[model samples]
Target: MNPPVPLAKLLPVPKDLTGRLALAGGGLFLGQWFLGDLLHVPGGGLGVLLTGAGVWWLSRGSTPPRFQEPASLQGWIARCREVLDQFETLEPDGGVRRQQLDAVVQRSGPQRLALVCVDPATCPQQGELEQALAGAAPLTLSVARPLASAEGARTWPTVLQEQELILFSLAAPLLAEDLLWIQQLPEDQPTWLLVRSTAGESDRHCSESLLAQLPARWVDRVLVQRPDGLLRDVLQPLRRQLGAPIRNLQDTRQRLLRGLHQQWQADLEQVRRRRFQALQQRTQWIVAASVLASPLPSLDLLAVAVANGLMLREMGTLWGTDLQPDVLREAAGQLARAALAQGVVEWSSQMLLGLAKLDGGSWLVAGTMQAISAAYLTRVVGRSMADWLALNAGVDALDLERLKREAPVLVAKAAEQERLDWGGFMKQSQQWLLHATS
Candidate 1:
């Protein structure tokens, strides 16, 4: 890493814990004096503590402070790497992703797609539809019975090696529950729901309702079957939608490979996001608990530092970055400091109105407010740290100067986003308060 930015060049603000504490003490004194002397509020100590909490809460929105922009995208990523290197351990959960990627890479023969039918009774024969698109591949197509059958899952892989792809033609009406199950399939294959006409007023015409319940992303992947339309009529749009070649088995495999790779990447990203959220949530509550245990209930970074450091290390594990622990604490420290600078503690304490809604604002007893604020700050730090890890993946590391330049920007973005999501967070806090109180 490059030499740290010269102290003179740094922002002319409280840059150390001691200095900031001094500043906070000064603010508390001033507020106490204002409230007690000028405003004539009784109880000096109570007035001071309440004023301190109020000042921090009201001023929470004022920071994570902006900084000069990095020169380039790679530079920004590099800066993230530098900060992470000091505190992050690279260890991504790549085993599963690699196995899936290898499935795409090692397999040379036919690819597979699931053809689900909402009304099995009225669906056309699989061969007819295959024949309608004869030019799309070298005519070695076969249909599987049902995805619900004992042999359903192995059907695709165990198909003849000569076959380029075995389109699963499950001979069963896909119920809503089946739709839910299909979404969890590890194969993550593209599905085409065949919407045929009702089987002669047998109440099988509810394909529209089934289609609507699918996740919004899968809505357009349907193939509406008509009462009298030929199989060719069905093949026309399917081919166009997939941009399939009229003839060329090689081209078909390549197209399938590309689509598979894209889908697999999307699947991996979704997994990462979900896992990160789980980690953040777990870390936040842990920090909240620590805050409750600590004697000093005011906004102190100590409650979050250790827990957030572990969080950063785990996050690094998800990205396959092996970070050193001694150095990792430094990374968490940086983020914690950034969070405090951003007024996360005060921002979370802004729940004064929210507490009033919960049992006449009695939730402030025994430092409940501090515990929740600590949790909120932990969330902000973890979120910003996740972003840094994501961008730092596969990029070169940078100098200390660059990190100094970019760290605040990253934290600011996370703070702003968390602020927008405050409504949801407050609800979670409400539940936590009830649990703790109970």
Candidate 2:
């Protein structure tokens, strides 16, 4: 299989050197003819220059915004690394890497610690627990008894509000009230659950059960205490769970930044796709406009055939297909025939006349009508080509007879669903034409 075309390659304005020179020269000659022949201008050379400049301006204006490649996952990771390096530089003494409990105490400034016990007898005494918690900043430790009674329930909320760090020691299965109390706790507060399974139960089961009962957001960390291990062992796991032991604020902010970058990348890709689709549609309209401007019979049809063929080929690149020229030509011819059979010329002409009346100009009426009709026909052709490409997989599999039969329905549907926005379409086409010349 062929490698997919990069979006950068797929989206740049079409390049046709011969066509560009032809248009520029034609525009210059026509400009002189109109100014010198019709309006009796004094200087023919100046008229030529002005016409060339106008053509250049129109092509430049029609050109789409420069394409930007989406940021890769590696790029995002590198950005994150840069941010981490900055954090490290700010705190050379490892101030940002402090333990979770220590960081909380330092940041919150001398706050109380509330330790809850499901079974009061199994929990360590306040003094012994306080001794284990002792570090650079001493914390005032208090034990909150389980919500076994109405009085216990009333005291739990007060204890939670008074403390910065609330640790729950599960020595028994949590009751409904215990789960409810944990759920009701303010999500902003840092709460930890330390599971100390009973003799008859499995520690993992107890941990899983307690986690399932409590809201995941309500608990900041879940620590599993080894039945025979030191309290210090639980501290390391707590720090890891907290993500940043030294600076919880900085750690949380870093995570949010990473998430924002990921979202931004996704959003950027979506915007690129939308813009490409709009450009693709505008290019089709430009071809139609060119066809409408032609006064000779069969010339507009020929333009439509050639323009739609090139448009389809470009679209094929987008769809990851390398369409053959013969296939594209045949497909274009089928679509052009369908447009003629469906009376698209008459319908589009009528629609253009309606638009011209709204603008109010007799001289512009014919040109405008032709331009819009071409746009309408080209739009129908593009849509049909897109459908054929999707259904048949490539131009090779296109059924010209079937496409001919289906073309009129597709045109009518597109006409009803999409109203012509000529102002923007014309502006884009002019820019594209000018860009091609340059």
Candidate 3:
């Protein structure tokens, strides 16, 4: 017998029919010449013809069919169909299946593929599913574990980053923490939960429980695989589900930021309100002290008006409104005038005298009455500005008469909450008074 031809040479046939026919005829002629002339065999030409025909048939059978590179969604689907056809011939093994999946991903260009094994021990069709997925396609498979523990929770974000398509196998009931962790994952991640029914529980009951725990918007698709069914039965549906490309990480980040923005806005409002209150108290004390130190009565009102205007503008900013300086000044003037007209100045003097008596009368001095009056007016104006800002921002509503009545009560409540630092207030008042006069 002639030396055996190389296995590689025999495997792949030529693309065109003409090339295949020529190869077959050439092989027949060579075989006939070798057997008939050299070996002197009877019916050598027919034997050689039969041998050549057999070789041609085997070459045709072994040759891998050529496929065009997919450039569109439909083309990609066609390519997937071709891969599925090839998968039909592969044996169900991990290595073989992994290689096949890698091929598909490579062709598709570093795509993410999630292999969700629902209770792998109970699901006998996992091996078949893995084998069916193995092809020349480029894909990265991430086997997700239940995030019930701290260690398992750490793996959650890593899986999201590494895999594009998450194949989740839901064989058991999800815990509250697990459901929470899954909900926290990027909303754009295309997740397909492969839910397999168990013998202990009814399928409908189990599916309903799972559905209730999971956010409807977060899950892209829910595929139910029966315990009696084959894994390959759902392969076609899986392919159809993966037809759409995975959403980009940037898009996922944007969506996450948007979701958090509303919460952040609320937190920021709380911080602003706290800051506004603290600053308002401090500003009132400074304005009161400055007015007390001022020799002119007109300068006392001017200092209070300036301090109140600045404080009101800041309050407006905290409430998400940009109040014009003129508007703030007008509001401050109205509140300051109302406080003076309501005899708040006389009441404040009597309160301060009592407070001074409690403090060993060190605060009882020549301009103490004017300082008390100015301080009271400052507190009233600040409280009014806060209420007006709240009203403008739709947080609260109050008419002028109601606001005027509430002003003294709010100021008194604020004073009761925290003691005034008399020494510090006097020092701050002196500095502010000096600055204003200069």
Return the top candidate by lDDT: 1
Global Cα RMSD, each model: 14.3, 17.4, 40.2
TM-score for all predictions?
Answer: 0.43, 0.32, 0.41
- Per-residue alpha-carbon lDDT of candidate 1 for residues 337-434, written as tens digits (9 for 90 to 100): 56655556555665643564676747664356656766887888788777766654434362233444566787889999998988898788778767
- Which parts of model 3 are misplaced by more than 4 Å? 1-140, 143-169, 175-193, 200-205, 212-221, 228-242, 246-250, 256-286, 293-302, 311-354, 364-438
When sorted by lDDT, best at the front, the candidate numbers are: 1, 2, 3
In angstroms, the error of model 2 at 131 is 54
Model 2 alpha-carbon miss at residue 126, Å = 47
Candidate 3 lDDT score at position 128: 67
Model 3 earns a TM-score of 0.41
Alpha carbon lDDT of each predicted model:
0.53, 0.51, 0.51
Candidate 3 C-alpha lDDT tens digits along 100-208: 3344344433556655442345333445666756552545555554344465543355435445567666565664544555665566566667777766676577667
Worst 10 residues of 2 by lDDT: 61-70
Off by over 4 Å in 2: 1-276, 279-282, 288-299, 358-363, 394-405, 420-438
